[model samples]
Target: MSNTDHLTALKDKIQAVEDGSIVAITMPVNIYLQEAEDMARCARIDIAELATINVTEVQIDDLQARIGACREVQSLWVEDQHKANQAEDLWADIQVQANELKSELIHTFRYAYRKDEHLMSAIADIAEGSTNSDTIQDLNDLSVLGKGNTDALTAINFDLTKLDTAADIAVNGADALAVANGSRQRGSDTKVLRDKAYTYLKESVDDIRAAGKFLFRNEPKKLKGYTSKYWKKRNQSVKKESDVESEI
Candidate 1:
């Protein structure tokens, strides 16, 4: 399905399921889905036997559709998440550079206004806040302050073009930061949708597993097909760690 169809199905499924746990997503989505697919295949083979509990062929087809929706949504979510992460990384680097330049310009402003109390107070206003957004605004403020008092800066041998650079950095950094924040929000939104799709799928999977477990309870090999190997190993590892901690 196209991403739009996946997203639409995601919304509908999310509305259809209102009580799924948001936690215990222990394994990666890809690995968990692979195990689920294996279990689903087993369930398909034993579906006739699963008739006692009403796990019909219709349910199996529904499970497959849910899986497809999840796979497509998962891919989109991962792409958005990667973009958000990259944007955040770039923002951090840009913030560092902007802060460094801000520090330089603030120091220069202080030196240029050292003998003038009125102008020093202006410098104080420009240097008030230290947040990323505040720092970007300060760059703009400093550029204006420097240009307005170019004579004093020139007397201190300041290059005029540095003011232009400060103004440009302020505009560039603000635009980049805005884009980064928007990307992060998009990633967060997509993650919630993906979780909903997962839950919708888990409902079908667990229902089928419940039936399979009951049908194959007398046969060990058949019973194993209904279980989750990924979760079993994860639970075992957690229990082992807990045991060691208790011993300590």
Candidate 2:
């Protein structure tokens, strides 16, 4: 698909949230990844240049030494092999740094893309609305806008409260939505209120997932892997519980 089409599809997928009214939302992860790829490509090019320099420096050093060692030396060719060695060392260091950067870029891409998938799924869920009739009835009952003798003013106030709470959480959370906003104030800005609301919904999905993991920790279905630094720090209670159980 064309780039425009791809972006449109992505937007459509996200916009499905809240009966397609959440069109203001943008995926910060995707945006950041695109910029990161550009930066990584540039760094790779620089590394390639360093590699070339290393080869040229070594070759030139060897040529100069060969000529200097020749007899009938009227002109002295002072070959600074030390300088060439230093250049080789620097080039090796640059290659190592570049490789590390590339690995980091790959890891970041995987993480961000996974997050994007989750957000898209959440958006789809919100779009589908309530599937169960009983749940739908209950939601309609609790909805401030529904037929419960609630006037438009009251409904608007309730929505404002929900939106405000969501915005506050999104702004404080590590989700790319807030990061994409460039500044915290932008999240609260009138121009991006809808966008903030969309991000809040996205964060709600994260909260749900975290809660599920906590609740299902004892189940055998729980997969083992490296925990994120943030989760490792925050999930101390789980670790403590596990340790206590192991002792028993």
Candidate 3:
């Protein structure tokens, strides 16, 4: 394959692994071994069939190098899957903390307001437009408006404005908390796929090793012996020459 094609294949494999579609390690050993051998055989045939391409040794070396670099990137990326859970946990904790603080603040405000009857009465007077002049009420009492007390009215208006502002802020903050909580939930949902990918990829290494041993148990076709050497040589050859990188 061309360098770009090779890298694309690797990317597709990694994506499949991450998305929980690649089941290389989950298949029966015999079947996996058979598929692997078939792939190797086809690869050899394809290389030999490319005899008419007029390909040069330098070009082959460069392609191999590119493939090696792609592999290094794939390895690093797969290894980083462990961090997915950490992020999910962090977002969950943040959501909890945010919600707790919001609830506590709201509860405290309600408790304080309910405990103070004078404060509530002032608010009620403002709502009902009560102007009983025989009693001296707090500035929040709308009677201050009838008394032509602009200063007290302004202060009451300011307090009312503050209440409105506080209500708006609380609403907006609740919405934000809901969104944050949703994000944490979504992250938790995708965690299963990530976990499966990590488990499958980790076990696949041992599975391949076992398959190699099983394949070589009876015969000496040298296929088992050449697995590492063949891929190493191919990588080195492709590195010396390659094509323009392509997006996945």
Candidate 4:
């Protein structure tokens, strides 16, 4: 075939293989989704449990007791205001953690989807003979691209790690900003710390994006059959069977 014809033929083969791989990819995607959902649900349940315990209730009660002991209403009001401020601070910290977990869940889903796409593309290239066969000796080779225990597992662990790191940075940066804002209201020195925290947050976001791009890069080869050896083995088996039948 001419080069153009060969490429066209290869494309057709690739399309067929891609169709098959898409079906295979679905199983892994579902598995990853289930695992991610379970994890997110567990985290939310834990947070809810903590909230139910009403640990903050103790602090509020302590504040009330102190207020009752004060002779002046003004002094009681000041204590109450301080306690309210502390409660607000605690709530903000919880909010940051919740947001971080939400971001992590999103990252997990995206990583799983991306992994599915990569596997499908790789399988297509292999079926089309467009990739180096040596690079993908079998399905095991394809599994290495994923983060699971076996080659068949398509979990993208590396992507998850990067996302978690980014989430931590974002949560910490937001907390720092809240602190700086509160400090400013009290006429305390905080501008320098705020600037530093913001810079770190920006760097963290950039790193996350870079890591995602690296993971999403295209594979150069695909997995293919060892047709020549397979055919040779088949012929040998056939010949042996024929000789045995003749002897009979």
How does model 4 score by TM-score?
Answer: 0.20
Question: Who is ahead in lDDT, 2 or 3?
Answer: 3
TM-score, cand. 3? 0.31
Per-residue lDDT of candidate 1, residues 1-248 (tens digit): 55457456556756565545654565689987887788889888887888767778888877777777877778889999898888888788888888998999889889888998988998898788988899999999989888888999999899999889889889989988998999989988778878877887787777888888888999999899988888789899999999999999
* TM-score per model over all chains: 0.88, 0.17, 0.31, 0.20
**lDDT score, residue 71, model 4?**
16
Per-residue alpha-carbon lDDT of candidate 4 for residues 20-68, written as tens digits (9 for 90 to 100): 2322122232232233333233323333332444323333332222222
Clashes counted in candidate 2 amount to 0
Q: Which is the better candidate, 1 or 4, if ranked by lDDT?
A: 1
Q: For residue 232, what is the lDDT in candidate 1? A: 83
Q: All candidates: CA RMSD in angstroms?
A: 2.7, 30.7, 17.1, 37.7
Task: List the candidate 2 regions with Cα displacement exceeding 4 Å.
Answer: 1-7, 10-201, 207-211, 220-229, 234-248
Off by over 4 Å in 3: 1-159, 213-248
* lDDT comparison, 1 vs 2, better candidate: 1
What lDDT does candidate 2 reach at residue 124? 38
The residue pairs found clashing in candidate 1 are: none
Q: List, residue by residue over 1-248, the lDDT tens digit for candidate 3.
A: 64345445444454455553534434333333344444344334444333344333343343343333344443434444444455546545544543444344333333445555765554444344222211112122222332332343354343334333334444444455455555556655444433343344334434433444454456555345425444556677676555323321
Which parts of model 4 are misplaced by more than 4 Å? Answer: 1-71, 113-154, 158-248
Most lDDT-accurate candidate: 1
Which candidate comes out best when scored by TM-score?
A: 1
Cα lDDT tens digits, model 2, 36-67, are 33323332333344343332333323222222
